[model samples]
Target: MKWTDINDIAIELADSQPDTDPLKVNFVDLRDWVMALPGFDDDPKHCGEKILEAIQQAWIDEVA
Candidate 1:
């Protein structure tokens, strides 16, 4: 997968919940879809390690 692959989280959530309301999807479904995307496929963070690092460092940062 390309390193620059982009994602439309909202759209993916909606598509996965075609029969149900998008806003009402279960957390697991949304999380799974987002994680499955190529954009997030190569994520270096595992089990909140990176997030915990960022939080411990307490530095201002940007996602993209």
Candidate 2:
């Protein structure tokens, strides 16, 4: 998955971290978790605030 695959990444995160709250996650931890996802294949430098926000929102939606 690439940086654009926010929903997919969110689903993975939700499943992997069911006890954690996405809304409370910081960008540093979020970036690291996303990068650690099994199929993730994006450049770390490609991530930005907007992408992180989108990912966080998607994760919130997934858990909701």
Candidate 3:
């Protein structure tokens, strides 16, 4: 999944880190966690603050 696949990434993150809070995650760790997700395949350079914020919001929604 690429950075554009925001919902998918959020789902994966929600499932992988059920105990973690998305709001508390810093961008650096969030980026690393996203990269570490299985099936995640994208150029790291493609990601930016906007994408990270979207992902974090999506993850929060997923778990909610």
List the global CA lDDT of all models: 0.39, 0.96, 0.97
Please give each candidate's TM-score.
Answer: 0.36, 0.97, 0.97
Candidate 1 vs candidate 3: which has greater lDDT?
Answer: 3
Q: What is the C-alpha RMSD of each candidate to the true structure, in Å?
A: 9.2, 0.4, 0.5
Q: After superposition, how far is residue 55 of candidate 1 from its true place, in Å?
A: 21
Pull out the clashing pairs in model 2.
none
Q: What is the lDDT of candidate 3?
A: 0.97
lDDT of 3 by residue, 1-64 (tens): 9999999999999999989999999999999999999999999999999999999999999988
Which 10 successive residues of model 3 have the least lDDT summed? 14-23
Task: Name the candidate that leads on lDDT.
Answer: 3
Model 2, which residues run further than 4 Å from truth? Answer: none
Give the per-residue lDDT of model 2 (tens digit) for 9-64.
99999999999999899999999999999999999999999999999999999999
lDDT of 3 at 62: 93
